[model samples]
Structure formats: structure tokens, C-alpha cells
Target chain A: MAKVKHHNIPLDQIIKPENIVFKRTKLFTDNVLSYCPGCGHGVAHRLILEVLEEMGIADKTIGIAPVGCSVLAYEFMDIDMQEAAHGRAPALATGIKRTNPDKFVFAYQGDGDLAAIGTAETIHTANRGENITVIFINNGIYGMTGGQMAPTTIYGMKTSTTPYGRDPKQMGHPLKITEIVAQLPGTCYVTRQAVHTPALVRKAKKAIRKAFEYQKQNKGLSFVEIVSNCNSGWKMTPVQAVKWLEENMLPYYPLGDLKDIGLD
Target chain B: MIVGAIVVDTERCKGCELCTQACPFGIISMSEDVNSKGYHYAYLADPYACTGCENCALVCPDTVITVYRMKVEEPSKAKN
Candidate 1:
């Protein structure tokens, strides 16, 4: 049941690299992910790192991780990483990119980080047409601060803050930051994807890759929004969280590219 | 003929059942016993039925599953 299970198979057959079907990407360190079980941050981290490795930009790429479950992203991703103040990953990325124009810079931020406290920075960076990429994870609720309502929380979604459910009259409406960012003149590509299922993971990875490719070509502001499941924060089992997301979240934050202006 | 298999890292597995749902062949299931992490880790219930599609690995948040596959040409009827 262990590595010894291959005892009957020929040594050469089992040891060959070509016969290897799947293995952990080397871009990720041996460090175990700190994200909660069934948390989508792990998948999002892996997909983005895989793309950076595949594109051979791992050595030169720089990452700005916002405060949240992803704050320790520097621990897992083997590349150089910098932690930014809450909701200011975009501003830090702007400075880093300006100084090191040759490096591929990307900022990874959560819904609360990007759409709320960092809203001004997020908008201004994209509006100014910074040659950088931003990865947004919209899980509807604040995952790091004990499941509170976030800027992207659904209209009727329940959270620590919204115990009786989010009231549209008082809370206004769920922020569609991806759509807002897409309308910015500097944004060259904008897409919203998910990672709850295997098929969806592939699509999300492709979108991240496209954003990186645009960055490599000096495209202005490629933003990718990933709709992820927060089973822990949502107070549901892993299976139930995914099912709920497919049922409730999809209708509100649908997938697919919101805009693409090509290389300009 | 394709031979497929997966080795589970029981210690690191959080047993979230993501791999169970990702298995297209339905050969993966949760183990009744708990691991060091107090989670029921996933196991390959029917190894022979595995298509080596790598779906489980892709959706695995823990990265605790590794898939291996080997393809062999079918022997001719005369040899059979």
C-alpha cells in the first residue's frame, strides 16, 4: 500500500519520468499549506504558481500577498514574495513593478482586502494602467477575521456580522468589483473563474496563465477574479459548501471573461 | 491497456472528501479510520478501476494525492 506496491512492476517501468502521471509541482515548497481544509486558497495558490513556473518566470516574478489566509503565501510559493498592508497589495505591487520593470509582478488579494479597504488603491492602479496583474479571490465572506460579511458578500448571505442575513436596504448590494475594474481604461484583460471542481480548476488556471502572458507582453492591468468556496467560514461541510456555491454563488457571480482589450 | 494507481499521504490529508467527488471513476472513497490529523483520509477503493484521469490530484487542496499511470500496448490475439 505504500511505495512498495510497485514491487511486482519492473524497476525501469516504475522509475521512468515518462511514466509519471502526476506529481506535486516543484514551484511549491515542501511546506504544508496553512489554509483550512477545503479552503479554495490552496488551489488558487497552486494554480498561479504552476502557471508562473510553466512560463519560466518563477525566478524573475515577484508576488505581493495581502493580509488574510494568503498572508503566508510567501511560505509555500518558492519565489520571492512581499507582504503588503491590509488592502494595499496593489500599491506595493505598483512600486515594485516601477522599480523592477523587468520582473513580472502580481498582487493576490481577497474580496475584503481588494474591494473594501483597498478599493481606492485597486481602482487607481488599474485606472493608471499599471503593467501588472492582480488575482482576486471572492469567497463572499471574510475568511480570515472569523467569517464576517465582506464587500462581495451576497445580498442575503449570512455571516458573523450579518447574523440575520445581509440586508440590501442597509448593506446596499454585493460589490461587483471585477465588473467595475473591467471598465477601467487600463485593464487589458479581466476574467472571473472558479476552482471547486476539476474542470473549473483547469479553466481558472488557463485564465491565470493568460493574465501572466499579457503581463509578460507588457500589457496594462490584467485582473483575474476567482470565485472560491469557503467551507470553514460558511459553517458547512466541504461537500455542502461546494454544492451551495454551485447553487447560490454562481447565479450572482457568474464565470467567464468580463473584458479583454488585447495588448494595447 | 492503462495501469493506474494513487498513493495517499495519510498524515497530511485533511480528509475533506474533495478527491472523492473529483474521481470520475468513483473508485476513491473516504477511509473509515481517522489519521494523525483526526480526519478520514481518502483511499483508492478499486485500484483497477482507476482511469488515471488525474482529476483527484487537480482538485486536491492538500496536494496529498499522487497519481501514477503506465500504458501498455494490447497483445495480439495470436499471442493471447
Candidate 2:
């Protein structure tokens, strides 16, 4: 049904300049996001950029884009961004951070790019404690590749590669990559979060801001894993997929801090 | 008096409805008509009910919604 015109009052008259509470930040370009409708990637991207903008480091920050759905993240993020080969964002971020020590360097990668193809690079970056941030978006499957099973895909989840569902005996157990990195001494802060709701989104932003703050202090590696939803890949509507994630994904990949060395 | 309002960029919205669900006051709802992109956009169904909590803007994946809060004015002493 068509929305009724508001009380015959002009919008400008109703919404004044001083009454503005929130507006889009300039840190993001005008380009529309390429993510699917209701995809968590958009929220994750916004949170990261918002954190950078709030910290006043948008001009001095460099983002490394992975080879997955967000490979073109550089286009949307109005900051210096470099495209890395498949699963090589962490490695690229390490080189960038080491040379430009003053810049805030971060690698944005998906579960397939981080936990699968680039496992070695991901591990070593955290092991060496590279003074950088890693933003991992785990949607459980390879979203850009037609919904194939990913290393982080939970058990019994159906994917294009596993039509009958993921069999742990044949596919091996789902990888807890965030937990794996938290065990390493090099990681200064590591947390898992989501953005399905407002409260969760706020907490996720806090974690991201903390990650950047740690980066400013020259703290070791900081990793933030965001468990997200892939509606198109999972063959569900946006709403259904999010509900499924809450019911199925959260239990296997619980959200919380795994490691925090604290800011000195 | 109304304390809050929101502006939705109709063309940019994907009609995901997350904002509708996220609005604690249930003021936002999907439009019957579609935008230029053929997607139904969200609008404030009950504008006066908005509390400026920003919950809808925070959950909107497209980032098309902007929230505004009104400033409460004190009574003028000159009137006395």
C-alpha cells in the first residue's frame, strides 16, 4: 500500500538541521554496495569504516581486500585499498603495515579466503604478531563461488558442494580459525561478533574500534571475526537466513572475546 | 510534540525489511509501491512514534536511512 503523505507538512520543515541525530559518513563512497539484499557484508563494511572515521584515521588508513565477495570493497570504502590475490590479504597487509608503520592497516577477508585458501598466511600474520587489524567475515560458505562448502562451514549444513549436508567424517570438522589465532601469543586482541540486530551491531562496532585503538598503540595482531549470513547462498530469504543463523550458526560459533591482551 | 524523524533514500533501499524489524516502536513499514529498482522501500508508518533511538538506521544494511532527533526547548522567561 502507498504510504500516506505526512500530515501535509514538508519533510524539510519536519526535519531541521539541529535535529539530525545520524547521517551517512563521508568515509563511504556514493557507490551502492554490491552485496546481496540483507547481506551482513554491508553492515560489517559500514562498522569498519565507521570505526575508522570515528577514530579520525580514515585518511591514514589502508584496507586490504580479499578475493571473495568483498574483493571490490575498495570501491565502496573511500580510503586507500589494495587488492590481494586469493586469501593473501593478511600477507599483503603485513607488508603494507611494516613499511608504513604510521598507517592503520587492516585486511578484510571472508571465511573461505581466510580459513581455506589463505590459512598459512592468516596463521603466520597472527603468529608474527603483525601490528595490523584483520576483519574476518564468516558466512559459513563461499558466497561468491556459488555456495560451495567452506572450511568454516558447520556440520550438517547443506551447500552446493555438499548437497546431502556437510559430513564431518569426510569433510573434517568445521575450522575454528578465530580460536586458533587466539591461542597464539602474538595476537593482542581477538573477538567474535555479529550484526543481525542493533545491540549486536553496537557491540561489533565497539570491538572494531578497540581493534583500531590497539593498532594505534602498536599492539600485536588484532583479529575480529564477524559471523554473518548468506541468504542467496543458503537458498533462503533474507529474514529466514538471519533466523537460521541465530538458530544454527551461533551455537557452533559462539560470539565473544577469545583473547585480549588489553591496551597498556 | 514529535521528538524524532527519519529520511529513507528510497532508490538505494533494497527492501530487506531489517529496519522494520529493528525498529523497537514498530513505526517503520514497507511501501506498497516499488522504487526505481523495483524494490519496495521502507517508510515511517507512524512518524510521531519515533524515539530517535537510531535502531533502524543501525540495522539497515543499505545505509539509506538517516535519523533525526528534536531538541527540547525550555520555556522562555520573557513569557512570564
Candidate 3:
């Protein structure tokens, strides 16, 4: 079989359920992912889909994707997904969760979409305890719009809008949106995770699964922030970007749970 | 005998080395050859050493790795 002529391995061999260790979840569509070569969005999307599949909630859940790199989330995720205007995913999710309280609802957003343009909606929705899960992808730049500085961009980071690196005097500090929401009483579970390494990816997936579990319990708003990477925007190889994230981003946005009402 | 296999969607791979770093067995490596997308891709360089841990697949942001492992039956105690 190894000597077979370059065609894909026998379908039966690949699809044997007993031998499979890891494969794509049915919640993911046939569509190939649209993210850059090593962007963390792909891992994050797959983890959410896998969680839905494991929980058997693919048919009873709705996802809201706002503008930013994640705007096309509906194309890749097979579950029912809706597009929200820039930064308005929380608002759209709020409505959906309110009307369909029994169904699981989630809003997937990027740093620019959630911490910047959608800050008001994000804060308010979580403050109100909307019974929805918010999956925030923070790469510290506006990836889809060409790596402009986002609210999460750390000081001294260079982005298209911050050619000389971000000057705290001019741009203020990088917003800790997760911390902000965690302080609010509406949120039930708040955690920050990453997907750059195998250990980190597993932790991130577990966090997402926990968020879904919290939402299913109707335990107010559950916020899970994934500190991801954008290799293209960062002008680094996938390997380099992970290293850079460890050196720079992790210090500022440490991984771990900020608040867990579940434990209370 | 081989106990595990990894399949990559070569055309979809962007040659990110996340999988390379994730494989504890050091089995994955980047190919010098370019895929149709004009990017280097990752490949399994040491199939025999693979434990089918699936860590590479978990860290791959491109969702390119599919892992399969043969089920190993436990060996019975040797006859006295």
C-alpha cells in the first residue's frame, strides 16, 4: 500500500472508524478553511465544532460570526451560523439566545471585532447575562483588513496603523476585554487560552468545551478568549509566530481562568 | 510492523511547522517540495516511531493531519 501510485490512500483504510485516532468533525463543512497558513483561527474553529459534535448539539445550536477574519465562519462550520455586522456578534447572539433560550448560542469574534467596534455590545451583553457563549479570537491585529492595530495589540507592537510601534502615550494600553467582562457579574465562566502548542491547543479545546457546558446549564454569559496567532500579519513563520506569542503576548494575556462561577 | 499512519491533505497545507513541533516522536518534517499552492508542506518522516498520539493533528491550525493507529491487543503472560 505504501508503494501505491501517489493517489490518496485507500478510502476504506482512512475511514475505518476503529483505527481512526483523530479526524475532522461532522460540524465542519466540506469547505476548506480560509485562514492563512498557520493562523490560529483554524484550530479554534475546529475545536468548537468538535465540542458541538461531542455534545450532540450541532443541530440545536446557532453561531454568530462578526466581521473580521472570522466573518466567513459560516462557510467552514456546518452548523447553523449567521453573519453579524462588524463587532455586533454579541448583539445578534443576544437576540437569538433570548428568543430561543433552549437552543445553545455562541458568537465567534476577533480582537478588532470584539474589543474595538463591538466593545459596547460585548460589555452590555455579558453584563446583562445573556445566556450565550462568546468565543473571542484575539490576535492583536485586524487580520482581514490587513493587520491594522487592534484594541488588543500590545504596546510597542508594530502594525500597519502603528508603523513606529504602538505608543502607549498616543494609543493607550492594550485593552483587557476578558478581564473587563470577567469583573462583570453577568458572566459565569471566563477564561483565556491559546492554541500555539500541542499542550496549549488541548487546554484551549477543553476551555471551549467547558464554555459550552456552562451555556447549556444556562449559567449566564460564558466568555472564552483564545489568544491565537496570525503568522501572515505578524510577518513570521508559523514556528516563529508561536515563539513570538510566547515571548510577547503570553506575558500580557496569561492563560488560565479569570473567573469560574461553576466552581462556586 | 507499522502501527500508525498519518495522511496529509497536501494541497491544503501551507507548510506551517506547528505539527513539526507538536510531534513528540519528531516524526513530522517540512517538505522541500512545493504543493500546488506554492507552499512547502509537512510530512511524516518517521512513520515507524509514530505512537499515534495525534498531538500533531491537534496543533495543526490548517486541519491537515489525519491519524490512524492499529489497535494493539495486550500481550498475555508468558507460560511458566
Question: Which pairs clash in model 1?
Answer: none
Question: What DockQ, on C-alphas, does every prediction get?
Answer: 0.45, 0.44, 0.42
Write model 1 residue lDDT over A31-142, tens digit each, in one string. 9899888889988998998899789999999999998878899999999999999999999999999999999999999999999999999999999889999999999998
As a TM-score, model 3 comes out at 0.92
TM-score of chain B of 1: 0.89
Q: What local lDDT does model 2 show for residue A172? A: 97
Model 1: runs farther than 4 Å from truth?
A: A1-17, B75-79
Q: Relative to the true structure, how large is the alpha-carbon lDDT of every model?
A: 0.88, 0.90, 0.87
What is candidate 3's CAPRI-style docking category based on DockQ?
acceptable
Off by over 4 Å in 2: A1-14, B73-80
| A77 Cα displacement, candidate 1 (Å) | 0.8
Q: Which candidate is the best by lDDT?
A: 2
What CAPRI grade goes to candidate 1? acceptable
- Candidate 2: clashing pairs of residues: A1-B32
| Candidate rank order under DockQ | 1, 2, 3
Please give the fraction of native interface contacts (Cα pairs under 8 Å between A and B) kept by each candidate: 0.51, 0.56, 0.64
